[model samples]
Target: MAAIPAPLSHTVAAIDAAYVAAARNGDSLGVSMSQVIHPCDRALFYQFRWCAAPEPATGQRQRIFETGNVYERRLLDMLRMIGCDVFEIDETTGKQFRVELAGGHIRGKMDAVATGLPEAPETPHVVETKSANDKSFKAIVKGPVRETKPEHHAQLQLYMHAEGLRRGLYLVVNKNTDEIHAERVEYDPAFCLAIIARIERIVALDAPPARLHDDPTKKGAVECMFCSARAVV
Candidate 1:
């Protein structure tokens, strides 16, 4: 391998920095299933209602998110090539299936509601796709999502319930090795109801909920380190 010149490296760095800045500004209307299933209520409230400040993503974080989308697109194509009919858009409306709750204050654009798969060829499946690094991939394969990743489990449950689907296929692609893992998630109505109840409570609040930890200003607080509401500044 040859080392790049300093000028070329600096030029590419500047372009990435500009792209990250532009990507950081987006106008989200309401709470998506991703935040609802997460652990921190304060972070959820802050992001959903745009009350507290949020630090924008770094160039590296933006690149990581974009890479995951690339993985998802490639996997969807492979499934289609293998004879599975993946429906990313509605047949009539030509839009991804949209679910709105709480009078459109809470919503999600479902990834896909797919049909004609080898697992459940007769019934439509809510397809929840993810890409994981090696350690997380190993944990995901070892146990039910209830133990390994409850947030993602709840996310699938909510989507399936909203779509009136009784079954779903959870797909994970390992980034390190390109290994694929799949799980079938049966719909749970109770879980969906609970999640919806919480969303309503959070959104209806006058102010943001308490921080995930008692003293988020502390240097070593557990929640401060993890909460998205804790901005870099």
Candidate 2:
């Protein structure tokens, strides 16, 4: 088994410190850390839901959507079961770490960061947990797995870039079967540029794009089911 890279250890410490700071502020720093460390295709899917339609529906759909979180928790449990060191970072500091992403950087107090099972010590793997979002998950795994997504790869690539890591592991859990699917991804600069272009367009526009509906009339839309914006819309 290959040893965990020294640089990756430093990166993990930096990331953990950021999360610790963010949690202290009662913010979504953990969520952002989810993006940096895991960089799964589903993360982009949620971002799309947030940007396209902030509000969708409720009731049973909401329950189904809530399974995403449950699956993530279960996946974390599984990792712990396998003896991985899993830490919850501070949410507020997490946000600051994300802000650094815009400029292609990562900053935090900790050093000697590491990922994967410390006991096993193979090629480092960062596991991303997802629930029932098969489409996005497949898209990421389909080809030679690249670091970026068509729309938001920049954020993911930025994470890998900052960490000085080249590979990632994506773990997708099926809600119905409770089966865990795994895939390997490698970093690619071309793919990263494509995703960066998409984000740039979103940021440069005077108003939010029309295709990204903040509120849709569709009753069964996934975005409506669990979005925090559901109440206001």
Candidate 3:
């Protein structure tokens, strides 16, 4: 008889344990630009103020993040293969391109900046990448990033605004099918300015803003379902 196969469960458990062990909690560095676009102001306030501790990232979540990083690297390589001049780091600082506002409280990093695109050879554009599962990929493919994924759109806009660029190259990969969707996103000054104003106001507030809904089950309160501050707020 063939030797019994080792339990796959043990290997799976070890992988998960490794990811959990390496997870790090976020610092109390003002509001992240990535998070400032959250619809619920109170939630943002609570997060920035550290009123409630966020749940540690699950092993599965870490794995997903790593997968996204891999895809992003591949996307950048493809740009270079096509003769685009891609800059992933700022030469002066030897760090990823970053943006800060609200006295350095609101901050974010750009994935890359590239020129020599097939459409615009001379114009430099901020590069942003994302990987989504099939369902999400379908939704985003249906409409522009601003309409389908406002948070992502907000991030790209902020990056371009800080870089003083007029356009951004947004790329998203379908994790399931390995398909890519690319779009050119124009910077919206009005939108960026409004968000910056809100960030400044939030940083100065002594109290949390009103909840999007008193009832978590309300139609517009979907974000309340997984809110880290749900218990405290």
Per-residue C-alpha lDDT of model 1 across residues 20-102, encoded as one tens digit per residue: 87675445787876667767777777778676555566777788888999998777777788788888887778887787766
Highest lDDT model number: 3
lDDT of 2: 0.46
Full candidate order by TM-score, most accurate first:
3, 1, 2
Which 10 residues in a row give candidate 2 its minimum summed lDDT? Answer: 105-114
Q: lDDT of model 3 at residue 116? A: 96
TM-score for each of the candidates:
0.84, 0.48, 0.92
Off by over 4 Å in 1: 1-8, 21-24, 91-95, 217-221, 231-233
Which segments of model 2 are wrong by more than 4 Å?
1-53, 88-100, 103-114, 117-123, 133-158, 206-233
Question: After TM-score superposition, what is the CA distance of residue 57 in candidate 1 from its true location, in Å?
Answer: 3.6
Candidate 2, 142-193: lDDT as tens digits? 5433343422333334445555666555556665556676655566666555
In terms of lDDT, model 3 sits at: 0.88
* TM-score, structure 3 vs. true: 0.92
lDDT of 3 by residue, 35-72 (tens): 87998888888888888876777889999889999999
Candidate with better TM-score, 1 vs 3: 3
**What lDDT does candidate 3 reach at residue 94?**
99
As a whole number from 0 to 100, the lDDT of residue 109 in candidate 2 is 21
